[model samples]
Target: MAKKSKQYEYDLSEVKRLIGETDKNYREIAAETGCPYASVVYHGRKIRGRVNRMRQEELNIEEQQPVLSITEETTETPKMLSGGTALSISRSDVHIHDAEQEAAKMIKAARALGLNKVNITIDR
Candidate 1:
């Protein structure tokens, strides 16, 4: 099994962009973002983590804009003696850039709710 890294409040995308677009090292980026140096390294390596909470408001506004139309349901089944049913999921408003992070959160929620199956579709 893979080890899960702790999440930080700073944005990973911003860290990645700085790493790619600037000559500054991790220490400098960490100083600028008010985040610890180790957290910067963890985000740079793309280990398991959560998106920055600092962008929550911005993400919510983006979700409100709604550029895509999603009708949200499909019945799926597999052959079994005592057939079961899959509960429907509520509408998930996911942003194009934050799909992966949003999906992670969704999966976490499902697990917390003791759900056994989960399916996520990211429409480009």
Candidate 2:
């Protein structure tokens, strides 16, 4: 004949409730609640650690998102300046000296054609 092993019955809800109600260690919780010491230690630590990790992840996601503010002035399109023209070029596509050379050529041509008040804008 084979010998049968006996199982001890425990309530997980009661264990969790006790763990939440006190700052005591697993051993203290087990003694107070009449639950197994190992069960209290494992489940309590695991649940608490998981909650903490999830909170940290949420905080990280919040930090990564940019905060935007709404103001009345920013809703309207800006009006262009009168008699102003823009010459825009990318810095990576052309060097500053090369841009200066091109601007000089344009200016020389404009002056030869009797044109004045030319506006040139170079930005990175």
Best by lDDT: 1
User: Model 1 off-target regions past 4 Å?
Assistant: 1-74, 77-87, 90-93
Model 1 weakest lDDT span, ten residues long: 78-87
Per-model TM-score on C-alpha atoms: 0.31, 0.34
- Model 2 alpha-carbon miss at residue 42, Å: 1.2
State the lDDT of candidate 2 residue by residue for 1-124, as single tens digits. 9999656577888889877776676777788777888788788876665444456578677656653321112123333344564332222334333556666776776566555545554443
Count backbone overlaps in model 1: 0
Question: Taking the tens digit of each residue's C-alpha lDDT, what string does model 1 give over 1-124?
Answer: 9999776687767877876677566789998886779767786556323443346457788877765422224456622223464444434555567655666766676676666676554443
Provide the overall lDDT of each model, using Cα atoms, as 2-decimal numbers.
Answer: 0.61, 0.59
